[model samples]
Target: MARQGRHGATRRQPKGVAFDRWLDRVVTVAVLTAMVIGLTAVAAHWLL
Candidate 1:
């Protein structure tokens, strides 16, 4: 049997879980890329 939450029943679906994992990876990569870009910009500014 699936677990019940406060509002309703909750079940872990395989497709939903896989999608969540993929989305997490994409978001993590985007954040890392943004951070690297910002750091490079700062370094360039300091050097120039």
Candidate 2:
């Protein structure tokens, strides 16, 4: 039963468009976090 449940979960996982959308979200968040940190560093440099 446990093995079957694992197989079912994997089988039901997303594909194609859904996977692309998921990857896009991950990349966007990563980029935004980088930008925010970069901007903060620049601001601190200018202030000091």
Candidate 3:
């Protein structure tokens, strides 16, 4: 069961104080893309 109390269901704030919606999505996408590229490079290096 979900916990319920007087201070329950409170919205959690983002840790990034300066980030906004657009920047958040952009950063996520960029990070994911970079990770994919890095992993592909490692795999290619191992294969060749």
Deviation in angstroms for 37 in model 1? Answer: 0.3
**Order the candidates by lDDT, highest first — what do you get?**
1, 3, 2
> Looking at model 1, which ten-residue stretch has the lowest summed lDDT?
6-15
How many residue pairs collide in each prediction? 0, 0, 0
Cα lDDT of model 2 by residue, 1-48, tens digit: 444535344556455878899999999999999999999999999999
Off by over 4 Å in 1: 1-15
User: What TM value does model 2 have?
Assistant: 0.66
What is the C-alpha local distance difference test score of each model?
Answer: 0.91, 0.86, 0.89
Error of 2 at 9 (Å): 34
Tens digits of per-residue lDDT for model 1 on 12-47?
567688889999999999999999999999999999
Once fitted onto the true fold, the runs of candidate 3 whose alpha carbons sit more than 4 angstroms away are 1-19
Cα deviation in Å at residue 31, candidate 3?
A: 0.2
RMSD of each: 5.8, 5.6, 7.1
- Return the top candidate by TM-score: 1
Tell me the lDDT of model 3 at 10: 86
Candidate number that wins on TM-score, 1 or 3: 1
**TM-scores for every predicted model:** 0.69, 0.66, 0.60
